[model samples]
Target: MPAFSVMGEFEVIQRYFANSGRARKDTLIGVGDDGAVLQLREGYDLVVTTDTMVAGTHFFPDVDPRALGHKLVAVNISDLAAMGAEPAWLSLAMTLPKVEDPWLAAFADAFSETADYYDCQLVGGDTTRGPMTFTVVAKGQVPHGKMLTRRGAKVGDFIYVTGTLGDAGLGLRLCQGQVEVSKKHSAHILQRFHYPTARLAIGQALRTVASSAMDLSDGLYSDIQHLMHRSAVGASLDIERLPLSQALKDSCDRSTALALALSGGEDYELLFTVPESKKSMLDVLLSPYGVPVTCIGRITGAAGKLELRAGNEPFAYEHRGFEHFEK
Candidate 1:
């Protein structure tokens, strides 16, 4: 009889998860190659998304490791949310400077909590020794015939968003020590920056109704610009209609606060457009989801044009939100 031997990493993975739940009818190939093969589920479209966060660029060096871990996972979940998909699985690839037990413990605890909350599980991942960086690839499932896209917006659609805008942007400003955080608003701003809840439920609920949707990871202005460009339509957002957190307004004036809400980044809220007829139904349906849906603008018939209305007059923004290379 031959002695039994243990398999290596690749072999072990193949033996276990090769044909597992992660590989359903939608999966053409599960393992054993440089890349896995997948097919769009029949009647059901696939929604795939990826996000990366570097130590210095996306996050602070000395911040809470647990929150960082949760955010790394949650933000990616937000992308799936934007597509109105039910998150099914995720793969994590992490680069670490060193494996510190306490840090890993906290990070794993937070990661598990977040994944569990969203009913997502980690099916595949890899670890490497290097500077701190984390990347996630999340897979989501939507109804067979419905998946929201950025290019589907039609003129006269009502532009809406989940939750208040600009909190994360305000949080970042406070984090950088640029803006002073009042005693009353300090915790709110810090919490907004440390942990952002992805509007997963709202996204799913809007699938059949929303024409276009995206997460505001950058800022409302830039991300909306993306939606407008993809849809081949222009938009005019009413500044007065933009939602603001009481904490944010308490810290700054109306103009500055509005600008921050418009152009500040890292909000991770869902910006979606729905038909005017769907408004009342959406409002009643989404009330229990613990997220607010606010209509801030409307899509235009014209193409390649964007407008912003501040009070009675239009205002020109100096910058169109955050850009990586621009600064």
Candidate 2:
């Protein structure tokens, strides 16, 4: 028997899985040990990403476990999605206070669904006793010559983004009860927050064509600026051209909607750059993917600056997006 409801998965692992001396080819040694060893392959370039979701930090304490699982896994996949890598496997390390069968079932189901959708496998994990925290380490692979990166962007490349933005931010506002949303539009915003789709296919396809690429985990304003800064170039984005969701517009005015789309974070879409010459053909290739790819702006010669055009003057805002430490 255990106290305070349950012993938790961590306790089970600490008792059994840890230092059990399980030695597979993939793991030279695991558990009940000082450290774990990894077997690195030579032909395929390994893509690695890790993300942590904490209670009340990344997610609400009262969210659905299935959706929580989906979000946790999707965010990790989104990192590989940015690199145009094919997801292969994942390892989960989770901490929780008790064992909730319903929650675990739903979470596992959602996790399996996402992994299967990407043809990835969940190979290993560890559990612990504590406040709820979920960490996923996702592994992906890219060919020897084909991997997209942020450093390949050029001054004359056309900037593009897949799908709409700001819905997730709006969704967060709704979840926090910070914004008033009508019954008619509540579902859309809620879905955006609960289930953000990772644009993996688009990223893989663009790996060969896109000069530079990244996922818009943050706001477009901040993410685009990051690419500009890294590539040693500047950008001129058309404020009018940003894809504003109707869900946002129905809740707030146009200006507010534009600001959210521009600066609101966690859209999980891809922001990439392609040469001007490939623009037309790329558009045709992207159309069949059923996700809208919009050319919102162009890169410029000036480095480390971002200029937005809203009418004749520069589009100004105090801050453009979310920073992990900023309040």
Clashes of each: 2, 5
Query: For model 1, which pairs clash?
Result: 43-144, 44-144
lDDT of 2 by residue, 52-167 (tens): 98887788888898789888888888889989997777777878877676777677777767676776656567676689998999878888778888888888899888888888
Off by over 4 Å in 2: 1-43, 320-327
lDDT of 1 by residue, 157-275 (tens): 99998788888888887777678879998998888878999888888888868999999977888789899999999998888889899998898888778878888888889998988
The list of candidate 1 runs beyond 4 A from truth reads: 1-43, 320-327
Candidate 2, pairs of clashing residues: 10-127, 10-128, 18-32, 19-31, 19-32
Provide the lDDT at 247 for model 1: 93
- Please list the C-alpha lDDT of all candidates, in the order they appear: 0.78, 0.78
